[model samples]
Target: MIKFLLIVNRQGQLRLRKYFEEKVVTHGEQREIIRQCLSAVDKQNFLVEFKDFTVVYKKYGNLYFIAGITSNENELAVLELMHHMVETLDKYFDRVSEIDILYSLDRVHMVIDEMVVNGYILETSQPRILVPLQLLDVARK
Candidate 1:
């Protein structure tokens, strides 16, 4: 399958964005892996135009939230492939415990869940987490 990824170079300047025609030998591997990738980049309660961390997946686009010299752009490859999501995440690399961490879908999801729970929110989807908005609202109440 032709998968694309967005990766930020060592310079932290939205420099890398490319279409990777990665071939998956195993059946359904691409779908599953993509799900995982999205999961890694996932963060719940990331509202658009909020001037904070976010990650979004469109039909074939990306929207970067953290827009500055010190943005968490390690997912440059993922951002290039899909709509860049999440911004203002520099603290991930600034904090003592978060600095040494690697950004992945699972990690993102966990952090997002924690934040939402901390903020007293019921739950949130990754803009494209499979769960429909209508359902989410029902669950929220």
Candidate 2:
């Protein structure tokens, strides 16, 4: 199960953070986790083990999509999940970038929420995942 997802840049600036677990993590601990992930970005392995969880991360342009999952989770599957997310974002934004995520923060969150719920993947079909957002756009017109 996924415990949290973090979007951080090369400079250690956090863009988005979503926690799925019921436990509360303090801001300090969250910062430390980001720091650890940033430090491990240059490592050869994409999977990094922490005290209680494992981090699976992938880099897209200047942004890094990092997922903190249980030790028993499949790392490769998480990587694929990240790729799907990037592809979805790219399709939605016509070339997704850090700036796009920064500006459309809420929409980005919505997209992730569409893909995952309570730490588990709810949907993998991009078209199905996008339908609700499209409906929302049509409603606003």
CA lDDT of each prediction against the hidden true structure: 0.31, 0.86
- TM-score for each model: 0.20, 0.91
What would the TM-score be for candidate 1 when compared with the true structure? 0.20
Residue range 69-93, candidate 1, lDDT tens digits:
1124333433332331232122332
> How badly does each model clash, as a count of residue pairs?
29, 0
| Candidate 2 lDDT by residue in tens digits, 53-115 | 887888788998999899778888889989999999998889999998899898899999999
Candidate 1 ranges with C-alpha deviation above 4 Å:
1-85, 94-109, 116-141
Model 2: residues with Cα > 4 Å off, grouped in runs: 41-43
Best by lDDT: 2
For every candidate, C-alpha RMSD to the true structure in Å: 15.9, 1.6
